[model samples]
Structures are given as structure tokens and as C-alpha cells.
Target: MSQARPDHLTWRHRLVALAMGLSLLVLVVRMVELQVVNHERYIEQAADTRASGAATLTAPRGAILDATGYPLAISIDTWDIYIDRYVWAQDPDAASGAAIALAGMLGLDADQLMASGTSDDRGDILVQRRLPYERGAAIEEADLWGIRSLPSSIRSYPEGDLAGPLIGYVGLDNEGLWGVESDFDHLLRGQPGWVLHERDAVGRPIAFGQHAERAPEPGGEVQLTIDRFIQDIVERHLREALLEYQSSSGSILVMDPYTGAILAMASMPAVDLSAVGTDGAPEGEALAGSVRNRALTDLYEPGSVFKTITTAAALDLGLVNAESGYEDTGVAEVGGYAIRNWDFQAYGWVTVREYLQRSLNTGSVWLSQLIGAENFYDYVERFGFGEPTHIGLSGEAEGMIRTPEDQDWYPVDLATNSYGQGMAATPLQVLTAINSFANGGLLMRPYIVSRVVTNDEVRSYEPVEVRRVVSPATARTMANLMRDVVEGVEWHGARVDGYTVAGKTGTTIVSIPTGYDFDTTIASFAGFLPYERPAVSVLVKIDQPGGDVNLGGQVAAPVFAGVAADIMEYLDIPPSEQLVAGQ
Candidate 1:
């Protein structure tokens, strides 16, 4: 009986050993499958568990500088406060106290912050943006467990509302939104990088752990042709003129005729990019007119300012000379449409020079008849009309022009267009076309950005000629005629003391859903200083002025004189009295 019991115990021990061996074999197979067959999958899962990949490093945006290295739009270091709800949930009592303390410092409601800190559904929350460095440092020194502050920046316009439409603004993600900012966004916005950081159990960045980081590349700087002093002077006079004339809006542009560099582009009702409504939109009157770069974007009937095109065509086509004579009855009949002078009066038998001096519509139609429709359209196209200037600006509108080939063609269109009507043009387009005379009949491509400075190189923009619209002699003749107009008694208001300036004025009836509004007019004046040398060309426009002072000579001409005088003084341009007398 003792031998049988020993044998039974031995068999039971052997069965237990066999079962343990089978269990060990199964465990080894499962370990091999996980470690070798699906190694990459498990590795990625472990990495994801340690790091959420939620954080990103933002590169600094470039600075926008003025002609003399003055900062117009700049980026200043700022901080953003964020909250991690998981850490706060772990210590409700302590987090509540911290929330109250933080709320006091941040000027936030304590109860609301406390509730936000206690919530677990929200993983992370942005508490505040654009917090001052000093204030954020104070919060960090307090050693709040759940709160973290990240380095960021906000755009600052030091000049404050000056050249607002041109400098434009950026979004929260550091993306450019308008004007030059939008036009040159890719160059201004630098390349962003990434960092792979491990987190703790409570979703906090671990100081000592497996991590990787790639540094971001900073953006380059953009230097514009805009002169800060000139911009300020232009805006000051434009603001004063807007108030004095009680006009709804106004714009002024000062350009270098030789280099095609824009010295000053100012628009009234300017907005500060740093100032916005709570809903993240531009507020008030600035919202309506200031958001658009009016000099390039908005279009209107150019009125007499366009007569420069007609006069240039007439002179270039050899259809008339300054000594040519025409009989002006104050009215012109074309295709059953009667076009009359602005004053609705008669001035009979005026020379070609007197035709422009008196701004006779009948004389302009007569010149158009001599040039004919085909030749007229040819000259207009050659002058860069009815087309975009491609001036490296966003929201540029190519003003409308109806050719003889279009279905809307009529003979009266020629007469009206000849006298600067029946068509539309942007202020920049008008200025660009008229610039041909100032630039010796060479149409130069107007540019705002003068240069760009990067880490490696400095790039400069040179004068680009679109085409030669007329002969140099013709341009000189046209300029001489314009100089005669400025020196004449009719344009005496446009003259600056001690200097002879040449320009033209236009007061067009504002177009509406109907035919036109005679009550509202767009008064504009375009002129260049030191007529003989021709340095700067100034264009001024006042929209919908109040009272009886609605004429271009009455409203915009004086403003041009004021702006021209200031710019000439700033540029140290010597007056040319001898040159004026010679002309």
C-alpha cells in the first residue's frame, strides 16, 4: 500500500510539471508576436501616450520699415496664458485659491475662473493673450501648478494710424491679412519649426525626459519707399482738409516720378491695427473707409484729371500744338448728346493753350475728333489706362473703359471720355498715367517697396518703365502747357510760393445707381513740383464734400499746394524762380 501511494504522488507531480511547461511556451510566443511582428505600432503608441503633439513653435514675423529705416509695423514680444485642467482637478482646493489670486491679478472674475479650473471636460484653455512680459513673469513667479505662459508677439504700429491701409495687420496665428502684409506674406512670414516634448501623467511638460527640438528660422525685413516724414505731413493736411471741407473721405499720394518710388500714400479715417472691436473687426468710420487702400482700390470718374490723357494724346498725335486755335461755344454736340462746360458759360475762339487754361469741354471734343476714336483708344491703352498697374498691392481695381469694339460703344462715349467722363479710374491709375509727362513721356511702373533686407543679402528695386507713351519733346511740350496752366490766372490757387508746380484738376459728378448725382462730386487734383526738373508728383482727392465748395480747384487744389510745399521743404528742394520765368 505504501509503494502505490508514492507512485500516485509521483504521477501527480509529473502532470503538474507538464502543465507549467505548456504555459511557459504560450507566454514566449505571445511576447515574440508583440516585440517583433508589431514593433513599430507599439512604439508609436508608447510615444503618443508620452507626448500629445499639441505644442508648436512659432517663428517671428518680419518688420516693416519706412524709407529712412523707421519702423512702421513691428513685432514686440508678448505672452499668452494657458491652463491645464487635469492638474487643477487633482488639487481642487489649492487650484481654487490660485484661480482667485490669478483672477485678481488678471482682472478676471474669480468665480468663473475657479469653475473653469475645476472642469475636467476641457483639456486646455487659453486664459489670456498679449499679456505684458512683466505681468506674465509675476504669474510665473507665483509658481501656479496648472498655469503655463508661452512666448508670443503682437504687432505694434509706432506711428499710430499713419499709413494704416498700406501697412495692414496680422491674425492671431501670425498670418498676414491685408495690404502689404497680405501681398508679401510669404516673404514676411518665416518658416516654423517643431519640438517633440514628453509630458507627465498630469499632462505637464517633463523637464528631464526623451525630447527633440528644431529651431525656427526668423523672417526677413521689408523696407518700403514710403518716407515717414512725408507720410505724416500728408496725413496731417489730409485730415485738416477733410475737416475743413466736411468731406466724407480723402486720399493723398506723393510719388517720385523718376524712380517710380512711392514717397507717401495717405488715406483719411485711418485705423490702428492694434485697436479692434471685441468681435475682432475694425470699428466705427475706420471700418467703412480705412480698411481699404483707397489710392489703389477705389475707382471713380477722374473728371478733368483725365484730360491730361486727352491732351497728351493730342500733342503726341501731332493733331494740335500749343499755338493751335479752336472756337469754344462752351458746348459740344456728339451723337445727340450735348456736353457743356462745368460753369455752363461761353468763351469763344481760344487758343489750344487757353483751351486747357479755361478747361473747355468743346475744345477737348474737337481735339478728340482730330485724333479720332481708333487713335484715341490707342493712346489711352498706350498710357496704361483700363488696366491694372501690377504695383504689388492687394485689392487693386482695374478701372473700367469701354472701347469702340464693345457692345456699349457710341460716338458720344468718345466725346465724354475725351473730357474725362463715361469711364472710371483709380487714383493711382490716374497718377500713373499723368506721370508719363513728368517722367519725359516714359510710363514708369510705380512701386512701394524700395528694398528688402534678408540675413544673406539686400535686394533693391529699380525703376521699371512700362512703355514710352509719347516723345520726349511731346512730354516737354505737354509739361510746358501744364506749367502755363499753373502760372495762368485760372489756376493761381494751385501755385506754391517761390516754386512753379504743374498739374490739372477735375470735379466729376459722383456716379450712383441712376445716371449721376450732380449734388455729390469727386474733387481731385494731380501735380508735380519744380515743374522743370519734376521731382515729386502729388495726387489729392476729396469725395462728397459739403457746402458750395465742391470744385476740384476749390477743394483739392489748395490741399495739393500745402502738401507739395511741406514735401519740398522736407526734401530740401531749392525753389526755381528763374526756371518759372523762363517757361
Candidate 2:
């Protein structure tokens, strides 16, 4: 028998029992709260862990249209076929059958598709890309296991290869790769949406499972300043010029002088949008060679075409007048270098009009000397040389100009630069600079896209005037001088039947890493038509004409005439009475 327990010990035992009961009560209350109050939260958490899948809803890329609202580049509904690897791994036999069925239906390699689906890494495997909408819909309706179809699109050019380089193309992911596509990709590619759905063990979307989706927003419509008819005419004339002149390559640009709108731009060896990625399409270096918009990318000496700038500067500064006389000894000596005229003949005591008509290099050197280096370079910079025009295009080059501040600068450079040698400029830059004359001495920034239309609003772009390079009087005088140059019998090739063309011809020797290629020349012409009220400013350049006759007036001038004449007629521009009277 045990002795009677102490009172203190008994109380302690009772207290311990009370603490245990209280702890148990607290636990039961917490369990009730978790199970009843927050039941749905836990349920959602568990479901999320079990099935999590999301997919992108591709947005249709924007359509690129011409000024007349004709589509140049568009996106057509398509589909991307994918294989769920984990689901396929779960059943090898099913995977093989699916691959064979897909191969027969969509023209794919069964063995390759099977291997891709059964690879060690488990994820979605892309089996085919850019399938037609109807075919993809049929595949989806068949309900093949582990096979998936995602909404997609393929870029289509309805006009075929008409403006391939200018409109550019998209890549496999629908990302822009060149030209307008690359430059304005942000506006062209719309925001993509997404979908969330309950998935199975292999992360494949479950049929009839809970689904939620956000609709994709389509891209905006880009309206370019380009005219389809004008582009066709320019391209036709450029191709013909290249063939007739036996030139390796060529480019043509037509711009509205008053508005600085690019009506048409064409480059040779252009990629055909319809044939890209096909069996016979250009690839690697060949594709790269053909894809560039040479008018804005390639740099070359403007030759005599640059003389327009020199003459304008001189007239603007009052350094020379149209009747100012100069002695042409066939050569002008500067910095121990002899600069001679194209014909290597002397015209004794010639006026400024005669010198320009003859395209005398000596006369250009004399005028540059009068304007001085500082003022001449200042004028050049004001006219937008040695810099990019920032014309919203990919791969636009900023041409090189040597100034007195540079280490390589020489005194002879002033003379050569005046005649458009010992320096370089893109064809677009040359045209833009000369366009100042037609625009009444105002230099306007060149642009391609005229407006962008979106679902919500339309943003129209206007002509941007940069600055005035010369006085209106000086511009009028220069225009008259240019008109005289084109009207001269020697440059008859540049004449239009019912138009007075104010123009200049350029024939530059191809400069190489080692000296120059004397056998080849870049023949070019820059001009504006209707003399009094200029409608279009045109530039035509042909590279490396074979055989004889590589002069700009002979090879490129005729091309300009053809393009300008057609454009004038298409635009319903009437023949000028001034031109007819002058003729």
C-alpha cells in the first residue's frame, strides 16, 4: 500500500492534465479553420501542382500597303504542328503510329518525327511549320494523341517580287529581317496573347479540361508612300538599263521633290518574296547579296553629279554668278595633284554656264577655291552629306567625307570633293541633296511610310523640312543652269519628249582597296522634271557596264527619262508649255 499523496503533488498532476487538454483544443480549432474556412484555397493549390500548361496565341503581323491602299506584304493564317514528347514517350507504339500518320498527311519524314518525339529531353517538339489552315484544322479534327497545332501565319506578297527589298520579309518566328519590316517592326508586330488550360501528367492539354484564353490583337496597317505603278515602271526601266548597258547591277529611286516622298525605289539582284525558302531560292551569301537595298546601303563617288552642290554653294555665297568667267586650261593644280576635265580638253575663257554644261572638273576646283574650305564644308554639312538621312530603313549607311580637321585631309581633297571624288555618298543622299534645288533650296528629310493605321487610331506622317540650304534666288539660278546642262546636245539622252529636265550626269571610276578599277565605272544621273514646277526628283545608277560607253548620260540618263515619262503620264501630269516653247 502507498502512503497518502502530498497535496502539492496532487495539484501539480491536475495542472499538467489541464495544459494537455488546452493544447488538444487549440489543435482541433486550427484543423476546423483549415478544413472548412480555407478549403477552396488548398484545393486550388493542389490542382495547380497537378496540371499547369500555357500556350501563345500568335497575332497576325501587320499588312504593308502602298499609297493607293494595295497590299504589298500580308500575313495569311497558318499553323505550326508540334509533338508532345512526354506523352509520346508514355506509349512508343502510339508515337510511331502518330508520326507515320502525320508524315502521310502533312508530307513529313516519319523517322525524323519519331526520333524528335522520343528524344531524351522531354518537351514540345516542332514537327512541321507553316501548314495551311485547312490542313491544320483537319489534323486537329482527327484527334491524334500527343499531336498539337498552334495558330500561326506566313508572310505573303500578293504582288510577287514587285517591291521585295523595300517591303522586306519576316523570319521563321515572324520577326522582321530587313528594310521596312525591320525598321518599323514594333508597329508591324502586334502584341501576342496567351491561353491557360488544365494539363495531364505529361503536361499536355487535357481534352474538355478547364480552359481560359485572351484573344490576340492583330497588328496595324502600314501605308507606304510608294506607288505600285511607279515602282513597276522604275523596276522595268532599271532592268532594261542593266541589260542594255551590260551592267552587273543597278538601282533607281524616284522621289517627290515638293513632299520628299519616295514614289519608287528598285535595286537589282533583288530577292523574290514568293520564292524565298523554296528549292531554288537564294541562301547564305547569295541571299545576303541580293537582300540589301543598295540605294541606301551602297556608297560610291557621286562624280559630276556632286557638282550641283558645289555650284549651289558658290551661287549662294555670291562667290560666282551664272555668267562668272573662268579659265579652263584642261587641268587645275592643287596640293601637287593635277585635276583634269572628263574630256581632257581646254575651253578658254568660259562662263560658269559653259563650264557646268561641259562638266569641267577644273571649273569645280576654281569655284571651291573661291568658296574656301570652311564655307564649302559648311555648305556640304548643311546639305546633309557625311551623315545619314534617317529614312526609316535598315542598313542605311552614313557616307564618308574628309574635312580639314581629319588627319588624312589634304589640300587636294577640297578640289576632288568639289567634283565628287576622294569621298563617298549613298545614292539616296545624292538624290536628296540635289532635291534641294527642286524644292526651292529647302532640304527635306526623305521618308517611305506615309501613314500607320491601327485599330484605335490613324497616325499620318507629313513632309519634314530640315533646313534651307540656299536662297530661293540661288536655287532658281542653279535650276536654270541644270536645265541648260540637260538641254545641251551632248546630254540629249536625258531629255524627255514633253518635259524640260534639270539634271546632271555622273561617271565615277570604281575605287578598290588597291587604287581604282579603271575598266569599270558607276554611271549615274540625278535630275528633276517639268523644270518650272518639279514633280519628281530621280536618281539612276548602273554599276560596271561592260564593253564601251560607260558614261552616265549614255547609260543612266535614258533610264531616268523612261521612268520619269511613265510616272508623269500615270499621274496625269500635263506637258509644260514652258518646256514645249523652249523646245
Candidate 3:
């Protein structure tokens, strides 16, 4: 005791003690501030450090199903991969290894993968993501120290190019950008859920502290009017027709005549939505190819397709009977707008059947004149032209009937419009008008969506008649005359043997800007099966079909015949063998 008291502490010892005391106190204060003052914040950070990971937990998007529940688009389980840049930096050469590993997992070029940008702050790199589980597991088993995989989802189209345009794709952030996906994004994209927990100094979850997770709820499924078999038929024939006609672009639409439910819709140059990000093409180019929905968004002067409406107008207004006659010196001048046949050769005299059979522009003009502009315009409006179909698709064109809206309706406008010129409409618009004729008299709004289904219940979209656009009597006579346009003697017989095919052919010259020497044409044909109680109405439009023989009767009508005949046979609807000999 005496020795200890006598040997007092040195100055250095006292100074060291004081420094230790201050450091301990400071740490205590900091701990209290972090653990109590901002308890939730620090706890969350602690959880993240120990067990949890900051990541985008992608919510599963809704499935797009055909009418019979065949999936057009579906989301499948995938792996979300992350990389610890700090760990990779440990071995400088490992960065290349990391890229090589990811590229192998993703079936991508190793060089391209190695060069992708990374977060400069050494944050966890969202490296390869949405990998199929097996591929991700393989990468993980390789013990790529810098890499980790978490659960995620990616949209997959199993049918490969089937209804690709209809069911659009989503991004990693689960954003809908086009087609039905974008149109019904809110309903399709479900709410994302999160996890709350504590972590250590390093960003790893605590593994047990207040571990809370709210699993994501899947979105409702949308059932479309598309029949997978029917869609396949439409696609095949459209491509075949495009090849046969050597056209720049083609559109084929098949819809239920009475209900307006679109059975099959196909457009050339359609994009596979799932291929947007997963393919070799640069991201920008892949996206550019799918910017527009050709069937609904694009509009063209519906050459002969417009004639169906004119034919309906003629019959409805009693301007011409089924056997009405006309004189076709191969040309007819009306209201100072000279209309001529594509051949520029006049038949001294022809019946209405021969006029339409040959797709004579003059004959259509004469019919419109006989019906009078007011009456003709009324029938056109009744056909649902010049207005949005409101089919729940994004970016629908209302189409154009310039003369109807203009008070100063020039004779040229009226005359050109009657024969499908001076008028612009989309393929969908043409389908709707023709469907009315196919349905006998009633006009129904064309719809692609057939049902909305959740896991527990299904909401079916029943067909509702929007309006009776024409009298049954008017519809019958129009169909009769249109029957002639298909089977009539004056033009190419665009009819399937054993089927009572009734259709109209149209050839519209694209409006050339002043001083342009070249002439461009849009040829179209619209028809229905059996002439009455039709199961489907098929409309085929070929744009810029430049050839020595470029009439709708030659180009588009034949396409209608091919598609409609196949569809009828598929449905087991026996051919009526109905004939129309001369337009």
C-alpha cells in the first residue's frame, strides 16, 4: 500500500487515460444518437447491412391471354443479379471475369458485357438480371464472389411472334411502354411491396431483426378477343399475300361480324415484344421498330375498302337496285372531278355489277352522286368512319372524311371520296364498317379485349350492339351487290369455290403532292363468309402495291378470299358457293 501511494502516475499515463475516456464517451453519445434519436433509420440501415439488399423487386405484370386462355404474354420467374464492385476490385482482373461470367449466363458477348458502365461509388452493380433461374444458379455455383442473385420476373411470349404486337413488353423497372400493356398500364402493373429489417456496418441484413416482408400481389389477367388459331391463320396468309403481291406492307384483320370482337389481327413488320431487350440489336433500335401499332395507329386512303360504305350508302338510299345498270365508257366525270377505271379503257355500257367487279372509280362516284352527298355522308358516318372506335387500344386513328366536315364540299372532294380517295382511314376503321355489313344491319364497336380475369373471378366482355347502322333491308341489298364485286365477270373472280363469298374491291391512288411524278396506290379488299349470318369479316389492305396489275380486285381481294376461305373452312362453315358475276 505505502509503495503504491508513493509512486504516483506519470504525466503520459494521465494523458492517455483522459484520451481514452473522451473517446469512449464520444462513442457512447454517437451510439445513443443513432440508436435512439433516429432509431428506425439506423435500424433499417443495420438490417440492410446484415441481411437485406436494396433492389428493385419487380412486380409481376398481368398475363395477356387469347379468348380461349392461350397466353399471348406471360411473366416467368427469373433471377435478379447484383455485383459487389468492391469485391471485384480486390482482383483487378476479376472485372473481366465478372463480365465473362455474366455474359455466359445471359448468352451475351463477353466484351460487350465487360464494357458496360458501373456505379463509380462502388455501389452494388445491377449486373445481369432477369436471368432464368438455372442460368443464375450456375453463375452462383461458380462462386463469383462479386455476384449475387435475387428473385425477379421477366415477360415471356411463349408463342413466339404470336400476338407480339398486342401484348407489349415491360422493362426491369416494370414499366409498360406500348400496345395493350401501355394502354392498361395501371390495371396491369400491380403495386410493389418492400422488406424492412436491420443491417450491420457492411450492407448485409441482420437476418432476424424485425424482419418484415410484404410479398407482391399479381395483377389481373386480360383476355383478348384474339383466337390463337385464328391469329395464326391471319398472320400466315398476310405474309403469304404480301409475298404474292410484292407489297410494301400489309394488314389483315378478322373480326366477328355481329359482335365486332376482333378474332385475329395481323400486320407485317410486327415486333416480338420480348425480344426488345434480350436480343443482339442495340436497345434503341429494338425499341424503334415497335413504336407504332400498325393496325390501329396508321391510316391510309382505304382504296376499294371504302367502297363497301359507298355500296351500303347506295343500297340504303335506294340510289341503285341489286341489278342497277351504268354506262362505263371506262370513265365517268362527276362534279368536274373526272373518275376513271384503273385500265383507262371504257366499256361503252355496264351494269352496276360490272362497274364494281372491275373496281371502276367512275362507277363508285356515280353511285355516290345518285345517292346525293348528304345521304352518302350520312351512311358513311353511320358506318363509324371519321370517329374513334374506342376499342381500348392505345393511339387509335379516328380516320378522315374531309368532305363531310367541310361546308364548301367541292364536287372533286365528293367524287374522289366516293371511290375511296379524298378519305383516309385505318385498317380497323375499314373492318368496323365491313363488319356492319357482315352483321346484316347492326354496327358493333370493334373490341380486342374479351375478358378481365383475376385468380378468383372472370369478367367477360359480352358483345353489345352499339347501333343499327342500316336497315336489314338495306344491309341485304348491299351484300347482294357486293357479292357481284367478288364473283362478277368484269374483273378477277376473287371468290373461294363452294363458298358464297360476298366482298368489295377497292384501289385508291395515294394522294401525290404537287410536282411528284410517281403514283402510289393502296389496294384493299373486305369480305365476309356465306353472305349472311357471317361468322367473320376479313379485311386485307396492301399499301403501295406498285405493279402493272395493281387493282384491289387483283391484289387485296385475292387476299380476302384466301383468308376468309381458310377461316370458314376452319370453322366448318360450308361454302355457300354464292356468286356475284360482274360489278
How much does candidate 3 score in TM-score? 0.79
Q: What does the lDDT come to for candidate 1?
A: 0.84
Whole-model lDDT, model 3: 0.74
Residues 1-583, candidate 2: write the lDDT tens digits. 8998666767788999999999999999999888998865554555546533656778999999999999999999998888888778889999889989998898889898888888853567777788999999999887787898988888988888987888888988778888788888888889776666677766765789866666778998899999999999999998888888898888999999987899999999799887787998899988887888999999999999999899899999998899998888999999999888889899899888988888899999999999999999999999999999989887899999999999999999999999999999999999999999998999999999999988889999999999999999999999999999998656478899888889999999999999899888999999998897898999999998887799998888888899889988998777888546656
TM-score, candidate number 2 = 0.85
lDDT of 1 at 110: 81
Candidate 1: regions farther than 4 A off? 1-53, 91-114, 138-143, 199-209, 279-288, 455-457, 578-583
| Candidate 3 residue runs with Cα over 4 Å from true position | 1-53, 83-123, 135-148, 200-209, 272-275, 278-291, 326-330, 404-408, 455-457, 490-493, 515-518, 577-583
Q: Candidates ranked by TM-score, best first? A: 1, 2, 3
lDDT values for all models: 0.84, 0.88, 0.74
lDDT of 1 by residue, 419-469 (tens): 789898888988888888888999889999988877778999988998899
**Maximum-TM-score candidate:** 1
CA RMSD, predictions in order: 9.7, 8.0, 11.4
Better of 1 and 2 by lDDT: 2
Ranked by lDDT from best down, the candidates are: 2, 1, 3
lDDT of 3 by residue, 400-427 (tens): 7766558866877877788777778888
Candidate achieving higher TM-score, 2 or 3: 2
